[model samples]
Target: MEKPSDNSGFVDSLEKLLQLCEELGQQIDEIGACLYPPQEISSIEAALEKIRNIIDVLRGMQWFLRLMRLGGLQGASDAFLEACNGLRSSLRELASEISSSNTADIEARVENITLTDK
Candidate 1:
């Protein structure tokens, strides 16, 4: 089997990340439509807003990476792409869990997500 090029691997991971983001957004919207406490809804909305900002930053970084590739500089290195793929997998698992969970369980599920630099 032929090995995939670095660019192709990065692109595949990026595409998956975007798709997962969209899925998570839809899930959040569905949750919003349900009758939850006003405060919980507000908190969810705030979290969604932060997610939107992160997506925007990702888009900007994607463009920057593309420019770097075009300029003959190294784009995302293997380690970076691996990290991104790991994140995408984690997000996918999170989405799966959220979708399987009841409305009341969502807060608990969301609370499980934590950010720590490796």
Candidate 2:
């Protein structure tokens, strides 16, 4: 078991999560470029922007949690864990909404393009 003061694991995990958020943003951009209608693109872009904002909030929360832990605040660890879980749940739901919206159409279009280009 890792000690509470050892935050390397948490930092690494947060970094990975941030990286994944960036990748998701890029994919959204790709989908918007590929085949989404203009109106749909705007909707997707709005969601993507919200995701970017959420990522920023997550980064802020990570630093705040680290500082709180360093200050030896009571229950900081539990609070950090709870906050991380809540953010993760929010991200998951947002990702689910994005995927369910027009991802099938995007995937089908990409498949056709790939086959035709070969």
TM-score of each: 0.35, 0.32
Residue 93 error, candidate 1, Å: 1.6
Candidate 1: global Cα-lDDT?
0.56
Best by lDDT: 2
Summarize candidate 1's per-residue lDDT along 46-104 as a digit string, tens digits.
55555545555555466546655666766453344455556556546644655576666
Tens-place lDDT digits, model 2, residues 29-65 = 6645645343354565555566556556655665656
Q: In model 2, which range of ten residues has the least summed lDDT?
A: 109-118
State how far residue 2 of model 1 sits from its true place (Å): 38
Q: Which sections of candidate 1 miss by over 4 Å?
A: 1-76, 111-113
Clashing pairs in 1: none
